[model samples]
Target chain A: MTSLLYKDWSIIKKTRALYFSVLYFSLIMPSFQNMDFFGKSFLANSYYIFIIYLLFSYLTAYDYKYNSDNFIPAFPVTKKQIVAARYVFVALTFAACLVLQSVVRIVILVLKGQDINIMNIMDYGQAAILILVFSLYFGIVLPLYYKLGYQKLRLLMIGAAVISGTVSSVLSEVGLDMNRPLVMLFAVIISAVIYYFSFTISVNIYKNGN
Target chain B: MNKVLEVIGLEKHYDNFTLDKVSFSIEPGYIMGYIGPNGAGKTTTINAILDIIKPDKGKIMLFGKELNGNACEIKQRIGFIIGENAFYEFMNAKEMAGIISRFYKRWDWGLFNKYMREFELDPGKKIESYSRGMKVKFALACALSHHAELFILDEPTSGLDPVFRSELMEIFQQIISDGEKTILFSTHITSDLDNIADYITFIYQGRIVFSRDKDSIMTEFALVKGRKDQRDMVLGSGKIKGMLESDVGFSALTDDRNWFFRNAPGSLVIERATLEDIMVHFVRGNKKYDKLAI
Candidate 1:
């Protein structure tokens, strides 16, 4: 397991361009905007960062298909270790993104003479909730991407997301808070359930991936 | 006397392909040549052995243990080199080796570097910059560097030149010289196996047609060529599996080589069958015991 982690870390470092780009957009770009716009921009910035992280996570699944990490499976490593290492890698990536986001938020507040309430109890609570939701959402998506493959799932995911977003926008004009915090909470629960199943499916698929 | 790898009744079902009760065993100190034509279930069988694809039914025992429980432990002693250039294109050979080294507990960096030098592989260049032969050589270096007792290779010689192929074979011979390691090499390159394999297993249409000692298979199966008039005489013998008849005469596969040598005595060519000829004869479905040229 440690070996797997070391391998992934080295790969991630080698491909640091992707990581740096994400950091630049999420953490560096927001500071260039005015103070009054910081709060509003924060929401879009966070969501954009989430989307990019999700895409990177989805793309990492191709490591299996392309045989990038093919030799690892043939080593003295169990399937469980392989999956756990992957999960840990995702967790670390997200953690790095979160830290970058936090640093940017702090810098914006300082430059704006804003009340230092950003990291307050409510703010921390919201951040914690968002992390939980995003983690659960990704836990459901990453393994499926690995099993179904990147090409098929990438098209399906984009198509489905587009259709669903359009429908949700039209419904919101008719008065819908489906994107509200409460709804997000409920969705998180549902994602957790799906995540459990997806995890099991990936385990079975990988065990049989020869 | 230890059976390093044992596969019994292994089957994998696909929409277009079904691997039937395929079975073979590799004991320490011998090289098993897994020969077959394209899409002949050679890779599928190897995949099942490595648990890459779960078998529909059957048992795979490695190191005297059930495969499921001892996968990691069993895998530790095993090395694999697939036909595909499976590494990331962005990674140089040194970086790739470092990544690979972390996976095995008994990785020997010194030995890996030695093999890389021997194979003329540059460890600092990205795989994308490598020629096909270089990629193969690099992969082989990484695979053999670890303390592997058994090596499973799929078409390791496919794109390599004859000289390098011979060099790689020599390496395998040296690895097994101590009589404690084993190799299971699957390839369509018959000459590679002909020069090295102790046991030969032929797979056809997802099933094992035959697996025997190399010398025994060579002695048992004979390819006969003759003219058209001898067709009846050959068919009368009823020893042919199947035959292909052309304008020049016929070519066939037969188990009774001696019978053909003694009975069909006119203008017949009884040659020592090469591994490639045997593979082609079986795969072509021309099983006639006697091959008569018309």
Candidate 2:
């Protein structure tokens, strides 16, 4: 499993320049417009989610392009371990994106001569929402990729993105008070459950799949 | 004989194809040549053995242990090359080897470097720049570096040149020369096995035609060619397994060379069957005698 992580990181390392460029645009582009902190925060968070999604796509694309899906099984690793490594990868990427986004937020505030309270509760709430959205998106898509290879699941990925976007947008419009700590905690709990089940389903799909 | 690998009643089903209850075993210290034409479940069988594809119904025993739930442990003792689909294209050979080496507990870095130098593979070059032959060589380096007891290679010689192919055949000979390591080499190029393979397991359309000692198969099967008018005489001998007809003459495969010599027309020419002759006849020719047909 650690080897799989190292292999994936090696793949990501090759495309570091592209990923950094995406991160730059995702962070800086939202700050150019005249908007309140909440509005700017929302745009920056959305872009962060976009960047993570792009990274996920690149990871899966590399697997397909290099045919690692067929070869990795030959290694001394079980399908369950392979699937678990992917879940761990996503979790790590999510944590890294959050940290990067926080850094960018602080930089933006400092440039604007605004006060920086990096531990804003509302920011945590928003991050939790992003986590829920991403967890659900990956939760559905990873299993599909295992059951039907990347080529066959391309349309399904697009459909999943659309559905995730629509559902998250609707939840936001409903004016749910994500600022509440209890709400954030509930979201975290739900995402964790969803992620756990997703891992189980992905393992089964990969084990039984061709 | 100690069986290094044994597969029984392996089955896999797709919408268009199904790998029936195929069975075979390879003894230690020998090369088992797995021969089949294109789309003949050769890859499927190999996949099942590696547990890359889940079998519907089967039992795979590798090195005297069941290869089901203990895949990670069993896989460590086995090395495999699945065609040209085994490397990360963007990483250099050295980096790829590093990642693969971490998965095996007994990875031998010295052996890996030896193969790298021997195969003329540059460790710094990325795999995307490699030609097909280079990629295969890289895979071989990784497989052999782990000190695996059993090697399952799927068309390891497909894209290689003649010189390298023969060199690889020699390498296989050297691997099993220790009388401990074994190989299950799957290929459509029958000539690759003619000189080295100790056992031959032939599959056609998802079924095993035969699995036996290579020398036994060679001696038991014979190719007979005769004039078109003498087809009846050859067919009446009750020795024809498969037959093919052409403009000038008809050729047939028979299990018994003595039967062909005794009952065949005077114009008929009987010769020993090579692995290629047996595979081509069984796959392309019409089956006239199901009694002898595997």
Candidate 3:
């Protein structure tokens, strides 16, 4: 599992796009200070929407880099372990992105003669939202990756959109908005639960073949 | 343990094609040539052996253990090259090797360096910049450096020039020279197999036409040519597996070469069948006898 994670890191780290995209987003993020969509605190942070899209691109590209997952089984790892390594890779990269972007943002703030409170630089609420998006998007959509080939991106995209849309409508109907403290806690719990179930789903799909 | 790799009654079904009860095995220290026409389940079989795809109903044992039972351990002992480029194109060979080394328990960096030096591959150069032959050489180096007990190479020499391909065949020979390793290489390039393969398993349209040792298969099959008028005599001989009726003459494949030698009419030419001749007749000859089970 550790070696597989190293492979994933090596794959993206060597590519110029990973650095370029992260740096690009870091510089452009503060401009969206007033960027509150889906009714304010529903998204305490929206920058990772770009990250999610880039993750998709990377997933598609890396799967292609591995010859559509043909060469993955050549290694000394199980299909389940391979999927777990990917999840770990995702988590590690997200943490790295968070730290790098935060550090860059801090340097920019200090250069502009701003105060040095970490809390002031980043919203704790924003970090939690980032976690939610990470868990939610990956939990729901990534199993389809293991279940289907990358060639079915169009089908995956449509399926993802429909699922997310339906969830948003249902949440809005129940008045369980992210702005409410209890509702935010509930959303986090739900995402964590979905994340656990998603792992098993991905494993089964991978083991069973596409 | 006599066999390094054994596939028993392997079956995988697809919407369009199915691998039907495929069975073959490789001894501990021999190179097995897997020859087949396009879309004839060569890659599918390789995938099943490596556990890349689950067989609907079959068993694959590698290194004497069921592959599903001890996959990680078995995979650690096997190295494979399934495509033209099997590494990250953007990364240099050094970084790629670093990542690959971590995946195996017994990675030999010194041996890897030796191969890199011997193959004249610049370790710092990115794979995308390397030529196709260079890429294959790099892949071979990686496969060799791991000290793998088995090598599963699919069409490893398909696109190479004669020089590089010949060099690779020598490397393959050297790999099993110690008599501890085995190799199963699949290719449509039958000429390459004739020079080095110890055993040949020929498949046509998802069925095994024949699988036998190199010399035995070469001896068992013969290409016989004669005047077109002798076609009736050859047809009546009940020995022709497949025949091409051309304008000048008719060339037929027969397992009973000795029978033809004793019973040919005037002016019959008989020659030992090469692997290419065998495959060509199997596919391009009459459909009725193309799947002759020998």
Candidate 4:
């Protein structure tokens, strides 16, 4: 299981564009709050989610591009295990970025003698909400990736990420109070259900070659 | 397990191509050559065993365990190499080998390094920069390092040069010479298997044409060359599987070699059929391959 995630991580690091994207994102991630589109923190948070979706897409693209997708299944891992590992990797990538961005933000603020809220409960809640919402988008689209492949689904993944990210952000701004501690908890349960359902579909599509 | 692999009543249906009840098995410690023409379901069968594609109606057992329920466990004991550059092209031999090492429970880095040294491969060169033969050596290195009991290779020697192909055959021999490893080597290069393969499983149009030991195949099949006058009798012979003909003569494959040599006219030429001839005639299809128009 660790091997499969390592494979993805290795591919991500080897691809030049993706490696640079990781660097570029981490540098800009600390400032996602400074840029806003419609609602306060809309572009900031939604763009982060959108970029995460793209990073995941690019990783999948690289695998398909390199023909490693063909050989990955031949490894000593089951399809279900591969699916589970991917889901975990997605969560890990998001978590790692959040940690990095927070550290950088804290350092920048300290260097400027500004207030530090890096470990604020509200900030963690917002991060959790973003992950739940991101999982909701991934839950619907990842299965399609297994079916149609990375090339055909690349545009759809991007377009869907933008639209879904926008709609969720808009919802949080308007009525849902998605930032509420209670709603964030609710989102977690719902996101888990979606993740489970999507994983089952992805595994079936992959294992049966549908 | 007595059998390293057993595929029973295997059937996969596509709109245009269907694997119809494909069945074959390999006992432990034997090199089984899986020979078939392009689009003959060789890859499909290999994919099924690897669990890359599920079979519609059949069971695949590897190392005495059902593949459906125990694929992860069964797969650890199996190592495989498909086409060249199956590894990521951007990664060097060492990088690829390092990642592959994590997949197997018993990966031996020392053994892998030994193979790299013997193959004369530079560990730092990316796969894209390596020649086809070198890429194969890299893949083989990774496959062998895992201490796998069964090795499933698909067209491992197809794109390689003749010298490297022969060298690869020697490596394959050493792998199984210990009587502890098994190989299911799929390829159209029948000559490579002529010297190394203990058994041959021929698939044509998604069906098993013949699956038998090389010695048995050599003893049971014969190539008969005869005058036009004797063509009818040879064609009518129940033993004939496939035949090729010319205006003045005819050549046919017969299952009963002794009977063919004894009963054939003194003027006829009869000899043991080589593996290449056997595959060519079988792939050509029995009567469809005949040149009676001549």
**lDDT values, one for every candidate:** 0.72, 0.82, 0.79, 0.81
- The digit string of per-residue lDDT tens for model 3 on A42-90 reads 3223445445556556766776755837887778889989988877666
DockQ of 3: 0.65
Candidate scoring better on TM-score of 2 and 3: 2
Residues B1-294, candidate 4, lDDT per residue (tens digit)?
489899999999999999999888999999999998889989989988888778899999998889998888888888898855658888888888878988999999999999999999999988889888888888888889978999999999988889989999999989999998999999988998888899999998899988889989988887888888887787766677788777888778877889876776788788889888887766563656344221
Name the candidate that leads on TM-score.
4
* lDDT tens digits by residue: candidate 2, B142-232: 9999989999999998977888899899888988999999999899999999989999999999999889999988877899998988877
In model 2, what are the clashing residue pairs, if there are any?
none
Deviation in Å, model 4, residue A93 alpha carbon: 1.7
**Greater-lDDT candidate between 1 and 3:** 3
- DockQ, all models: 0.52, 0.76, 0.65, 0.68
What is the lDDT, from 0 to 100, of the residue A53 in candidate 4?
A: 81
After superposing candidate 2, which stretches have Cα over 4 Å from the reference?
A: A29-42, A108-118, A155-185, B263-266, B287-294
Indicate whether candidate 1 or candidate 4 has the larger TM-score: 4
Model 3 over residues B242-286: C-alpha lDDT tens digits? 887779988988988888788886488999998988888878876
Docking class of 4: medium
Residues forming the 10-long window of minimal summed lDDT in candidate 3 chain A: A38-47
Across A1-210, the per-residue lDDT of candidate 2 in tens digits comes to 998888788878887844784557555655542465543344444554556566667788888887787888889889899999988987888777766666667777788788876354136666667779988888887888787887787766665665565555555546455666576678879999999999999998888787
TM-score-sorted candidate list, best first: 4, 2, 3, 1
Candidate 3, residue A176: Cα displacement in angstroms equals 10
**How many steric overlaps are in each model, in order?**
17, 0, 0, 0
User: Lowest summed-lDDT stretch of 10 residues in model 2 chain B?
Assistant: B285-294
